[model samples]
Target: MKIQEKDGTIVDVFAIYWLENETLFLGLPKNYGGLISYKEKNVHVIDSTLNGEFNYFSTHINGIYHWALIKEALLDDIIERDEVAYNRFVEILKAEGRIDPDFY
Candidate 1:
């Protein structure tokens, strides 16, 4: 699925693997047919670190982490961390107020 950020930036444009647990893993194409690029590349050069590294970093990282959290939720078979992201999924379900008996 293609996801556009709130500001309309293309966060991810590649292949993905979605797990039953809701975690989405991004796969980078292999180089030379067997070499996987494991190390990260430099995106910027800063004399000082960005404020709240993970918080700022999370904006970019969240796309990857969100899917991972969903995977964890699915594996644990519970909807917990969805709360972190403004509890959107739960709020929608609560407002709708009906659990599909067939789904569970």
Candidate 2:
């Protein structure tokens, strides 16, 4: 269930705090809080200070989660690691009649 981040480090899919099925902000995980490492030279080195620096997503204007979606890179990792959840998401998209089969 490990996937590489945009920064090139691998992380477990479940290690992220995804807010699935919640009435608000459903499916987005807490984003990094200024602790993201850019251009990591050593992939083997794990940062001990990463845990307490996560920040939950928010918006200046409140709105329903009709557009709560993960980035395509994360989606690719989830699809590779978790079939059940990926299938459920596809089903939901199908139900909405908005899924582009080719894109998914």
Candidate 3:
């Protein structure tokens, strides 16, 4: 689904597997194809840190870590999670008041 951020930046959303113990979401948005540092930072690009990282994007929430945005490359991770239905992600967004119900 497409989510329009408060700043008018709408991006496609998908669900990916959660990385390790790090908190998720409400952080700066960054792009990465594989693992990278989970420490919070402000940057944009596909990170390639091998020791500790995973593909993730901030949920744009009001916290350091709370949510993440899924991308096309992480489809396998989403599927691997064995979600009951794809819309589960959408539901979570709606429940969290992140996206309007009609947006999806």
Candidate 4:
């Protein structure tokens, strides 16, 4: 998914770390390395969606953490776009058992 900055710059999202305690943490690439090299940099409440489809999220960028309401579709797209990463994350969740199998 692409996050647009106030100046119109777009940032591409890489992966999702997990959804914990009703919050979502997303992972983004940190260097020239691949997806495995990503690190968590953004967070938002899972149920913060408005109309059940939109919500604001926060991310730390350039020493500042900014918030913006983004389309939930974008988040779903990100997960769908990287099935391998998403599955790996789900496995981790299953191992931790933080969520019920039916929910994942």
Candidate 5:
């Protein structure tokens, strides 16, 4: 799928919540990388840097994802295109019940 950015850019997406089953850190930088984005069914984008201690976090962290661990199954290359892969990934997560319904 393709997601559009506020600037009118498109992104790709998949049909899987990559790390929905992982335990989330309530309040700590080690695991609390900050919100990336939110999908459905409680799936979230925590951090996806793969460079910091919070590599487990998804890169999509937005107002949508808060502390939830659920996130989209983005291809390794799509991480940088937040609008394309990231948003679509979040939608898939939401449809699959990964993101919290109350988030939006």
Candidate 6:
């Protein structure tokens, strides 16, 4: 998946994580390296494209740390601690149907 910032910057999205409270988190790497959210419609799905039979979703980036609205915690420490585990967790979410397959 691709995330297009308001400044027209596009970045690759590694995975999507869904919290127990229904908060959606995107596994992406920014300068600080953490997750992003789609609350408030600031971030939203724009389009889906096919590449070699693989479908990927494109989302527009408008807000930065919307996840903070749901919980007060630092994810950078957890994310930076073990990237492999983080990525694997995302894969689990996808496999468990927490992440929409259309965004693959």
| Maximum-TM-score candidate | 6
Residues 25-59 of candidate 6 have per-residue lDDT tens digits of 35343443345543323454443331112222333
Off-target runs (Cα >4 Å) in candidate 5 are: 1-73, 102-104
Model 2 stretches astray by more than 4 angstroms: 1-80, 100-104
The CA lDDT at 37 in model 5 is 28
- My TM-score estimates for the predictions, one after another, are 0.19, 0.25, 0.28, 0.27, 0.27, 0.32
The 10-residue segment with the lowest total lDDT in model 2: 28-37
State in Å the error of residue 77, model 5: 4.1
Between candidates 4 and 5, the one scoring higher on lDDT is: 5
Note the Cα lDDT for every prediction shown: 0.25, 0.33, 0.34, 0.33, 0.33, 0.41
Question: Which has the better TM-score: candidate 3, or candidate 6?
Answer: 6
Q: Name every residue pair that clashes in candidate 2.
A: none
When 2 and 3 are scored with lDDT, the better candidate is 3
Give the per-residue lDDT digits (tens) of candidate 4, residues 58-88.
4542111111113222333333445554454
Q: Which stretches of candidate 6 lie over 4 Å from their true place?
A: 17-25, 44-104
Off by more than 4 A, model 3: 1-9, 12-85
Give the true-structure RMSD of model 6: 11.4
Candidate 1 on 42-94: residue-level lDDT in tens?
Answer: 11111112111111113222333223225334312222222233233233323
lDDT of 6 at 70: 22
Considering only N, C-alpha and C atoms within 3 Å, which residue pairs clash in candidate 6? Answer: none
Residue-wise lDDT of candidate 2 within 50-82, one digit each (tens)?
221223334542322222123222333343446
lDDT of 3 by residue, 14-101 (tens): 3222445333222212222221222323222242222112344444322222233343232334334434333554455568765567
Candidate 5 has what TM-score?
Answer: 0.27
